[model samples]
Target: MAGIYIFSDRADIAAEIVGFARAAGKEAFVMALGEEAAQALTNAGADKIYAIDGDSELIESYAKDIAEFLIKAGAELFAVGATPRGRDLAARVAGYLDCAMASDVVSVEYHDNQLTCVRMLYGGAVQEKQVLSGLSVVTIPAGKFEPAQGESTIEALKLKADTRVSIVETAPIVKEGVDLSKAEKVVCVGMALDKEEDLQIARDLAAVLGAELGCTRSIAEERHWLPVESYIGISGAVIKPRLYISMGVSGQIQHVYGIRDANLIVAIDINEKAPIFKAADYGIVGDLYEVVPLLTEALKK
Candidate 1:
């Protein structure tokens, strides 16, 4: 039987890929770049670990060598996390290997020696199921799967350095607060807000719940109440927080598309017939101005 291989620079994501392998009744062999990453995979149910003993910078900068490695290793299925950088690397690897590939996969199944994946299409509006023939590359969506657990044996692999991209000083964006994309809880405000000062309610509630604050396109782009980074919509960030509480959001199709993946949606709006109610798991038909303060106080207590 051909072996299943899971690869990712992020240990947490690698853990999730291990989970996927377990769920499919397959053994997960990890290709790790560092000692810490290999240990993480071992603890998270990697059956075997292939450790690369060389300049880690070269692997992170180039996909060609890794693709060649997988192709030569006779990997039946290769998986990685579906982050921006991960997606880019996966595409290059797929191209180099000339293998079938899928991205942002939320579900995976291996049967009859074929890989089937369920992912979103058309900006998360529709779901598509695809089955791959022969060797394939798949990118798992982060936070979508629970991690697996077990111990593993580690082995060393010789480096194949073919670095094409050179790092020119890394710089971090000077933004404050949590990354809303990964936030477990999020509180978003929208056009229903009356004044810029009204945003204090959202800020206070977000603080009380220890959640990230987000807003609609109009609030971010038009009023500029919050930074563009905090905007959640078709043109903004797509999030899948566990608890997403939207206050005064009208739930336009584009806006709802951004939050469709959230586990639980609680919408608070004065308009009883607002479109948001259709998408909300729970909703309140009351003025947010009065409701937010009370909610915050309750959460604090």
Candidate 2:
């Protein structure tokens, strides 16, 4: 009843969430897809490894297998990564088991023999805290937990993936950029600058601070000045850095939700009353065009 089953198509993710199981003081079994994933997960601190016998490629196909094992083992909780594939598989398993599910879980607590999960609600407007009674599944995002390296045993099972859907073709999407979630210092741009050319101002600041560059949704989605991966908001990247300095970002709740976890949030905007100032640990009221260049110079000294 205290066993925790962790599953993720991505090996690193499965490893990352292992800390949660360890913190709960439960037997953690990690699901690895193939030998490659199994090798990557050897340092995941798992008590045991449940690997699919073959390189199934489509993790979603094994939804039934995963759901069946949880029931057979009577696992108390199913911890899954919140990636697209992970979400699909978790939903399918939830349906099969008819168990309560929590998505986008940011934090978890096992107190007094109960599992409580905190997740965002209404586009990050409020946080919903849930307590799991029966067998439950929770989807966790990256950077929420860190994994420690350790030895574990690998156990393989025959692949029992669903065959109703076939994968005709698979192509990898290329995304080139820093993983802002792991950044220590982040300098984010906003919609305030006059033109694309003005990005140099923000770039200069990031260069001086040795920080990763991020942006508002419009800077990447609509204007296309930066790649989609560079944006941070409700639907974009959620970052937790030591220092998050947002330049000219209007600080919509959607945007603030992403940066809320930063250790220190600094906002620079022309308007004194911008919502961003309210959320920032420190606020500077001035035009970014004037403020950034001076700030960059100060950091260089």
Candidate 3:
């Protein structure tokens, strides 16, 4: 049987990984970054736990130190969460081991001592199955699997690894408002907005609905109307909100990947033939400039 290693910040998710590994007849070792995370992974049925603590200000240095330990642990198939931190750590570790890494994997299976991973491509339009031929690193998206309950038996291990980098100072960029990922309702603006000033109209609609504002890659990158991190697509954030409102987004395969899991999708595009309408639960074919302001006022009232 192949040995599986799961690095997780949340114990529940770590346990779920452990369950999956056990079901596949693989030996599972869970590594946690903090005390709380360690305890949680142990409760989830981790055979071993590596607990490390450091200031969030020096995350890169801390992750490097942990990566050393992970390499020494001899994980044949390694997995991590597809979060910002997880991706960063996975990249660093994969580079150090000279291994291939896959991100946003939805599922994994083991057959004949080989690990196969399934990931969505072309905006959830296709599921790609990859069989890792050698040592591989995989980052899985959240909400892809259900958490399992288990007895807590955590075995703490000490790491003698040191980091090459050192932190000097840190300054955080704090944005005022709700995090789009945590928002139950989200309004996504696309390239069809036509003018930069039109973004404020979408913001107004979001404010009226108490939702967070997001945008497609074109609006976020090419136009610079929104932050790159706020962009949604196959290469960006995958949101599974209760309601997702897409305004003027033409629904490219890359952009549609992010909102495929939304409970209700309402799309507004002047072109009735827009691909977004095909996936939307409800669609309005009209100008967003007139429709958005009206919708905002209606919602406010």
Which number leads on TM-score?
Answer: 2
- The CA lDDT at 239 in model 2 is 92
Off by over 4 Å in 2: 143-150, 297-301
**lDDT string, candidate 3, 118-181, tens digits:** 8877668899888886778888766666564565555555543345555577689675434566
Alpha-carbon RMSD, each predicted model: 3.6, 2.6, 4.0
Candidate 3's TM-score? 0.77
Better of 1 and 3 by lDDT: 1
Off by over 4 Å in 1: 53-60, 179-185, 204-212, 221-223, 233-243, 261-264, 269-274, 284-301
- For model 1 the TM-score comes to 0.80
Better candidate by lDDT, 2 or 3: 2
Candidate 2 lDDT over 1-301, as tens digits, reads 3499998877777877888788777889888777677777887899888778743578888888888888888898888999999999888889888999998787887889888999888767888898988999899877678774588988886778777788899898788777888899999999997799998998899888889999999999889998888999889888999999999899999999889889999999998989999999998999898899999999899
Q: Whole-model Cα lDDT per candidate?
A: 0.83, 0.86, 0.76
Candidate 2: TM-score?
Answer: 0.87
Better of 1 and 2 by lDDT: 2
Q: Which ten residues in a row have the lowest lDDT in candidate 2?
A: 50-59
lDDT of 3: 0.76
* TM-score on alpha carbons, each prediction: 0.80, 0.87, 0.77
State which candidate has the highest lDDT. Answer: 2
